[model samples]
Target: MRTKDENMRVLVAEDEEVLAELVATGLRRAGFAVDTVYSGDAALAYLGLHDYDVVVLDRDLPRVHGDEVARRLVADASRTRILMLTASASMEDRVQGLDLGADDYLGKPFEFPELVSRVRALRRRSARPVPPVLERHGLRLDTVRRTAHRDGQELDLSPKEFAVLQILLEADGATVSAEELLERAWDANADPFTGAVRVAMSKLRGKLGEPALIRTVQGVGYAL
Candidate 1:
């Protein structure tokens, strides 16, 4: 089971660089961790390396083709949802894309807000079921309401901080590596060598306060 915050990762595979950047920027502004690739092959490479909640794929893609990419993803039984994007708006085209394993289809010149909404809806549908509320060590989190409290005291947490806390809590006392945290909390845009995880953990610990709830595994990572 995964939290909504942890499922905010998205991959945008559009051959048009401008459109890809525009979509990625909008998704990021909407609080989604997004990665963009200009080719279907690059999209496949990224998909192989990362766990994304949703993939916004262009139907007409270069190098391997978007339909083939969708087929491979479906054949692999990937949990990641696919949203096919194309200039074609025919009913038959939409049906064909859906039949090819896309969870949803969108015509080009679509509204950015609509894309965001569809992506969010797809992610919610793909996420594994989890308890609405998670509790451990006097810390309680409401996954549905997106709220957290420690010993009955409400904690004002940033989105990233909340995501990190949720991941740590979900680990159930197991150590979560920094790479894993970056994959889950952030997105492919994050630099692998960055200290973003350390900084987020620091803020999370500070918010948790007193009797620290997170423990660092020296060279490994952080644990609850």
Candidate 2:
């Protein structure tokens, strides 16, 4: 049985290069796996390749229009939620975007915190919403607060370590492959063979300590 508590994968589909990178960076810092695309066409292609939990789409995109992209996603019945962003703040624009199948709408010059909050809210309404906190094997993880504790002792963890731990806990004892961990915790630019996952797991185990909860399945993956 697969659990829907996997790390939230996000796509930022904005034509503005700076804004796209900024949003992606912000989301990544917030402990989400993010990818960016500067055009609606590119967004569509990425969507076809990966299953993203949310797509922050810009309404005015180069190559293909954002409206068409939303229509296509809706027509295909994708599980990916759409957060439409536009320069227009008019009620008509919001309604039009919603009618076009966007799950939520945000106007330009918006607050970054609000965007993150909106993304979290949208994700919570997915097939199975994960709690803000996760506990397993005497370890506790606070997703929103960005903190971790093991047996009531506070554990200092880096961003990568925290993300890896989160993914493992969300797996709910299921064996999660290294590729899936990299895909869900790191960005698209991360090289698969860089041993990054191995390094992160080592640090995480050190922080987690004692009982050696994380188990490597040799030819498979890691499970807790």
Q: Would you give me the overall lDDT of model 2?
A: 0.90
Clashing pairs in 1: none
Superpose all Cα atoms of candidate 1 onto the true structure and report the RMSD in Å to 1 decimal.
3.1
Specify the highest-TM-score model's number: 2
lDDT of each residue in 170-193, candidate 2, tens digit only? 888989989888887887778998
Model 1 backbone overlap count: 0
Superposed Cα deviation of residue 113, candidate 1 (Å): 3.9
Clashes of each: 0, 0
lDDT of each: 0.87, 0.90
Candidate 1: minimum summed lDDT over ten consecutive residues — where?
1-10
TM-score per prediction, in order, is 0.83, 0.95
